[model samples]
Target: MFCSGCGQALAAGQPVCPQCGRPVAAPPPPAVPNLAFEVANYANRVRALSTVWFIYGGLSLALGIVGLAFANSFLNGGGFWMHGPWAHGNFPFGPGFGSAIIHFAWVMVVLRSGLALVAGWGLMERAPWGRVVAIVAAFLSILKIPLGTALAIWTLVTLLGYRNTSLYDQL
Candidate 1:
């Protein structure tokens, strides 16, 4: 090694340069910030978010299926409330209007359910596109209110929070 002070050639582990008597300063150790806690926190949040997504998707799917069945029953004249003399004549919106609305609602429910399911799957699998899909789904879910709104906000914060972007990239 060469001494920094006098540029003198020194043997290994020398304490000082013999020519100039300059003490050898060992290089400082590389700085390595500990990220174990942050990583674990983010990982837990991701798992929880994905779990919530799955539960929400399942519930939505069930609700959509039930809604479809009810709509089918109503349209087919099988619902007791939709029968009798006042069924068709007393209806305010007239025929087929309610059916159209129900159809639209069921379709929306199915779409939302599908989106939630896909987001959950992507997140659980740690797919490259998972973050994007989850963000999109979270934005869409923000209007759902109560549980959905809370989940959406949490998801947004976890995935897009400061310093989280790089951590997720490592995953």
Candidate 2:
């Protein structure tokens, strides 16, 4: 027999070409993927991610609120040694240290929840800004351990693809 790809002579039962290493047998036809279906699927995935963003945002907001509630006890003179004269030495900022901590917690709560809410809305509506917000969220999410890391990686992969970008543009 002959290798159809390179036209090299081959033994009747040879599986591949000796000259070019091409398969002697004909290769199956390449499968043609459905473009429209793929685009629709991408859209669906974006929508699904939107839901996830909302969930994450809500969780962050709740946690932030909880943290804020407990910040005073944790940072201030309410816990152990809080009543001691050395408390001032322990916290150079003194009485204001606890307030500073509360402020910081509030900032975190606002920032994290705000970004998540914005990203979720944008993604759901397929707004141009949504992609930008999503990217930012992905980067920030990486700082969170475990679940956040996984979500961030998936978000980056899903939103950063060339085809996905084109798909977003169309949405």
Candidate 3:
């Protein structure tokens, strides 16, 4: 007989389920898969992928912060020797050119990190808007190649290709 608690096969006269330790009186309602089970399974997979987005967003934020710190230090320490002619103020844009580039990098980093965090949150909550944000983010992620491509594919499949439309609507 199958255990009611865990659905593991139970030998005759067994008092409790070995997998779940729950008492089993009869076979599970049926060995058949039901809609509830399928929905739960799909939701779990989506949540798992959402966790990946959170980690990616955090790393992006950290990397950006580090870049900002490095830029600030470099500017204050007068460590511009690597700029060649620009180091000697020979460039047409003057010495402020490096600062402008660093600022632009900081802006891009902030935008990327913010979007990632929002997308992660939305995916975890199964929000409809979050799905849209995640789709856009995934498309952008594809441009990153390799790892990003894999993540984007997984995210797209979990959110867009999921079989149950009702589950997301309820969430």
TM-score of each: 0.68, 0.73, 0.70
Q: What's the number of clashes in each of the models?
A: 0, 0, 0
Cα RMSD for candidates in order: 7.1, 7.4, 9.4
lDDT tens digits, residues 17-84, model 2? 99999877765798877777788889999999989989989988998888777766556646664665
lDDT of 1: 0.83
Winner of 2 and 3 under TM-score: 2
Model 3, stretches more than 4 Å misplaced?
1-31, 71-83, 88-92, 162-167
- Model 1 lDDT, residue 24, Cα: 95
Question: So what's the TM-score on candidate 3?
Answer: 0.70
Q: Report the C-alpha lDDT of model 1 over 92-151, residue by residue, as the tens digit.
A: 667766577778888898899999999998888878798889999999999988878998
Q: Please give the distance, in angstroms, between residue 5's alpha carbon in candidate 3 and its true position after superposition.
A: 36
Tens-digit per-residue lDDT, 143-171, candidate 3: 76776688888887777744645666655
lDDT scores of the candidates, listed in order: 0.83, 0.83, 0.79
Q: After superposition, how far is residue 3 of candidate 2 from its true place, in Å?
A: 24
